[model samples]
Target: MCGIVGYIGKNEIKEILLNGLKELEYRGYDSAGIAVLQDRELSTFKAVGKIINLENKLKDFSTQGFGIGIGHTRWATHGKPTEANAHPHIAEFSNVVHNGIIENYQEIKEMLQAKGHHFLSQTDTEVIVHLFEENLKNCDDSFKAFKKTIDTIKGAYAILLISKKDSTKIFYAKNGSPLIIARGEGGIYFASSDAPLIGLAQEVVYLEDGDIGFMQEGDFDKLQNIQPLNINKSFAQKDGYRYFMEKEIYEQHSVLLETMMGRVSEDRIALENLDRDFFEGIESITICACGTSYHSAMVGKYLLERFAKIRVNVVIASEFRYADFVIKENELFITISQSGETADTLEALKLVKKHHLKTLAICNVDNSSIVRESDRVILTRVGIEKGVASTKAFASQVLVLWMLGVFIAQEKKLINAQEIKEQAQAMLKATKATKVDSKLHERIKRLSKRYLHGHGFFFIGRDVFFPLALEGALKLKEISYLHAEGYASGEMKHGPIALADSHLFTIALMPEHLLFEKIKSNIEELSARDATICVISSQECEVADDMIFIPKASSYMEEFFSMMVALQILALEIAIKLGNDVDMPRNLAKSVTVE
Candidate 1:
């Protein structure tokens, strides 16, 4: 979740590392620091807050030809966001910047303390440099010492290690978290998120679990233990966007293209998985996930049941392992996760696997542990989601699950190709039209003050909008700290109508469903009680005081674009109103790579 960047080559190390950190400020902004090696001496600059703080502190320093450096932006986990807990943690001789959690840091701290290694800060990352210092004292090679230290640590991490003795080399390792390295005009550069290095280099390398890279001068080598590693780069076109989330949302069309690549050639969309041996006599499918993945699972349940007439259940991963559910022998279990290393979802996978169930994984990362463990795996081509709040990755998961539904329905001969192709075309149209424009921003800005004054919020929708409404409310509450609730539009009269008043900000999701008019009535009732209304639908309806509209789509497809639009509005307005950092929310990291 924290940002980690490193630079090694014949250039001004401080300037490169500092600029990289500035570019990656979106990933984390609580605190920033950099450790640079100069003339065989280690110099460190640590700031208790944003990258600007570090930049101000280094205003007078020389950014000359230093070949190696590492920088960090921390999102505090083990301690408060203070100077003492800020990153670029240094021991007597070693400096390190680490992302991800160290589960057994306390244990290791005690071990190191017994050996007379005094501690300086309350950070899990600080234990690392001390451990590295201890290892270097024993081993001849620093990289070998790094490997030995990693063998003792538990939990997820993407680390960059530097030493006073080895001023030219920067060593990095990753497991479960994202870390990318790019070869640049100056030298080799590394960053936690790719946005920092977008224009700097077109060639990039992604570091996966169990892989390490040793960088120095103009050359570098990847390794697994002592052996060399071979890496591949997947090219992508970013077009033009300020943020990855924006680029990714716009890339929905490309994602749809990829999903439909081999599926709908003429009219036939085949369901290859169901026709395989795994589902020959399968009676049911159980889906599990967390956060955005859980919403995809909910949509999967509806898709499978409505289209395939199959029995399916959706369960939250945190709750799945604790509950005693009936599991049949031929039943298939599908796990959906963006990272494929979510601790709760991974635990759920392990529990289900122990029971000898047939498992399939729908994940974004290929060759991930979930994919390796499952009997079958489907990978989403969402690329890297640098934003903490998921947008494009969630859309990609929904698209994949929808294709799975169409495939299964066709495999059973339940739906004809014409029907599936119509759906596919609708998806393509929706992706192409899912745009947030100036009009939407104007409406959202006008409604923000009203929403902030409201006592609580009620978001209502029908069918797929139920999940969409919940996700919208989640986004508002997650960072904005609003007290919000989501319900089916029809269920509003059942109980939620009682809470309707001038103090309520009612958000209605009225996509092109048969229940659209019914939701309009619910909006009318809220208006009658003097509650403010913000409606997201295909067109401006009569009940909406403020309306945000997008291109028409099937009700199922509307959820993806509608929720995305809603989230963008909420994120922007809330950030401005609350005076909080919109790009990097407090205590929230881009990825949850640790338990």
Candidate 2:
């Protein structure tokens, strides 16, 4: 994910743009740049690191008076994180800063090149500004030219465009990615999220999908929906913790409470946001998601099939977009995203909507693109998730998905009122059981020291735990920069056991119930192959070199919740021991706006 900030006002554009970028640091970026229109002259400056580097480069430069400028913090989707690959790309008269990938940039670039357009940078974003300038020739007005460009492009984007020919206005368009325009005292502003717009404006308007408009002299035409900025700067702060990831991990208790507030009761799963008829005719469910959300979908597949007696399919969002679907008339399509702007997931939802399918969205942010485009939405109640490596969001999604399984079961008359009550009570108990006691945390920290030196890791499990194994391996690979793989325990004996050695660390998720003896046998087989084993279970393992104990969960659903906390804490401790930035790991963004 990248960040976009624009201003057209009386304040110093340099300071406004720089401070705006600083506020967006938590979103994660490698390169940053700005283009300011002063005295009808567009001056562009760029740097290859943090906002401080950009500030240093602009130390001697001056933006004279009431200037319109657009700034961007780039995460290097299409090219390396260099000055040439930064944003605020300029072409002749038009300048653009973009978030999200431009899938058709190569084709568009070749078309522009055939027309004698010379490009300077290796970025899909450069194509956008060039296309805008090229369209100006045929269109009668700037507005038409901007609209034409938006229509021509075919990818996710939140664009901020300005022209040397007209200093009076700043143009914008948002497709799948996030872009919010705030009306400030001096001028109008634009940003990817409310992070930069928090202090500048109390009320902001979120640019809807396919929105193309302009802001001129503190006013513009694109005010479709305005809402109060509910969160403050304090929400973005790390508080006392050294990193936002740790703070978010510790906040799981409250986040789960927020997630389960109105939806879960003693005997029912009522989604107030969705109508009762949403699942009336649905016989099957198709869930599409990416990364951590995709893991939740896998668990959901098991939950829905086992508890609800419904046919469920889990597909990766990227693959689902290209695959032909055999959509049943009674099928319900569900999309999951932490930040509802995940490009692959959002686009997959749009592609499914083309089939006239009934769609439901499970997302954290209210009114995100996925939430807006889908027929129904269930918010995960995970407020501003700032960490690039997801923690709380992943846990909340599984919790919500489990509850959805219960809801579908009730709808199908497969589960009785008493069973629903048991499920609800178990959910509450599972959430409480997820808390990491100080002693367990201390043991995890000590064990992480040895784990920090492993050549590689294998997280092995079975059935529902298979997805948790994948999530655990992903967490390790993401934050610790380790080469780890997750596998179904049974699959290892076929071929992967060949790689097992003394240096290979295996984290075995063995619950007390639900095929416990079978999974324990899988662990013993791995141990016999000389793989170091760390077993997370309620029972003592005879073959374990190390073990982390959890309460004896009553159901697989509860084990799913508690095991997530164990894996997350282990990953966090290992990353911290290695002196890595767990929140913003290398080459990773909070949200993947690019496919």
Candidate 3:
């Protein structure tokens, strides 16, 4: 995956592109590069490393004025992160920047090479410029040339192309990767991630798969399958934060608010835009996802089964595609993905489609391909998450999933609207009480060495903590590289207790609810096993060993907010102590766009 930004505005093109790169650098730090059209040609600067490395090289270089430009921060899929693999991959006549993989690049590259198209970088993106060049020779216009090039592409790509002959204009296309265009005071702006232009533009028009966007000096429009698609100006708010990750974390509050925002005061809680009949007809839910999104699926399963009384199965997307499992038409298959283009999840979706099951996608980006492919879509309005390692997006997904369960319960006549509202309000209050300890760094530094006792972790909760446990274990493993495990509190004795010893670290998600004592006993049993107990519970549950208390709230929702703050603190602490890249962990990209 990569972060790409394009500009056709009144300001100096290089400055805007460079600044935007700095903002989007969290997506990928492997390398950075920019291309700007000037003096009848594309001028480029590229370097392998952080965006800062690219900036250093550009200190003496000059490419200026209101012209079309594109920038990229790459996470290598085609080639190693090196100068030779950097973006703004330029040919003699065209410059291209890409955000996703070109799966068949080798074959295409060999074909182009045989045709005497000389290559430069070791990137699949370089193949696109070659294809575009070949297409330009035959096409009558620029948009057609771009479309023809797109038609020839074999894999996912959201690309920006600037031609030397047409410096006044730029062409872009998207397929299985994100690309959004927005109007600015000067002109049009494009970004793979939304944060770069949050303050610059309030209105945005997202580019769908197979859609091409063209922007000239003062105007831009979109074309879907070579036909114009109406562009709408939908306002997106930043809500004020220096970093999008921080804003996203706090948006957990809004996610709770929106999920419980309006309607539903009767004995039955009302769910907007949800198909009650879909739930009624389904006997099972197979929730599938990858990475942080997978953790969300695990959490969703716990909520669905506990409250809605439905059988739920959680599967990793990559594994689900290969597993020999029968998918009945009556089963409801759910997929969770923050970026709807996650490679394995998309592949899994294709697998589920073959089964003729009722499908649903829970995602942050609306109208994403997965949402389009699914039978029903539940949009998590969690705004742009910029940091590579998800914080807010994951939290919001959990909150929405919880609401979904409550809605399903109500639809099934299991829970009341008053119950949903009370739980929702508790979640909001927890958000307010959820304090990011300013002294966390120092506290985490000291707590680092002490975590080794936890050879494995047991996360226990009753209603929602089942998935919360899985999520906690996932966080411990993702950055900390800890061999952590999560299971229901009652199920601990089944098989996991064999691992509980003095060296074991028990994480009890004991919210102040009906199952508090049950969770406390699980922690006590682990404690008796001589394990170190770390309780992530409500303020009411007074525990002695390493207790991180959360605010008291309704049982239905406290687990989510409590889980967020505790997990964040634990993740940062573990990463810092383990000397891991908390933001960009090894071999893990923010969005798994490539399968």
- Residue pairs in clash, model 3: 453-503, 454-505, 502-530
Candidate 2 lDDT (Cα, 0 to 1): 0.87
Candidate 1 residue pairs in clash (backbone atoms < 3 Å) = 271-407
Backbone clash numbers for all candidates listed = 1, 0, 3
Residue by residue across 1-595, what tens digits does model 3's lDDT show? 6888988866777778888887675555688899888767668889887777888887886655666788988888877988888888987778999987888889889998998899877888999988888877787687787787788888888998999857788788888777888776766888986657756665577777787757786464443222222322222334565334444544555454655455334344555567687777878888999988887777787778877898988899998888887777678888999878787898799787987888888887765678878888877665556556777677767767777787788778776667766755655665554445445434544666778544566666666667667777776776677788778888878888888777777777777665767778777777777777777765444443676655566554655665666766676666666777665666556677777
Tens digits of per-residue lDDT, candidate 2, 329-387, equal 88899999988888889888888788888999999988678888988888888778888
- Whole-model lDDT, model 3: 0.73
Ranking by lDDT: 2, 1, 3
RMSD of 3: 4.5
lDDT of 1 by residue, 179-275 (tens): 7777767678888766567556655676777877577765644422222222222223335654455455556656656655665544766533434
Segments of candidate 2 deviating more than 4 angstroms: 61-65, 107-116, 134-141, 220-222
Candidate 3 segments whose C-alpha is farther than 4 A from its true place:
135-145, 218-251, 263-266, 275-280, 350-357, 415-449, 452-463, 479-505, 511-531, 538-545, 551-560, 574-587
Model 1 — TM-score against the truth? 0.83
Worst 10 residues of 1 by lDDT: 224-233
Question: lDDT of all the models against the reference?
Answer: 0.74, 0.87, 0.73
lDDT for predicted candidate 1 compared with the true structure: 0.74
TM-score of each: 0.83, 0.94, 0.83
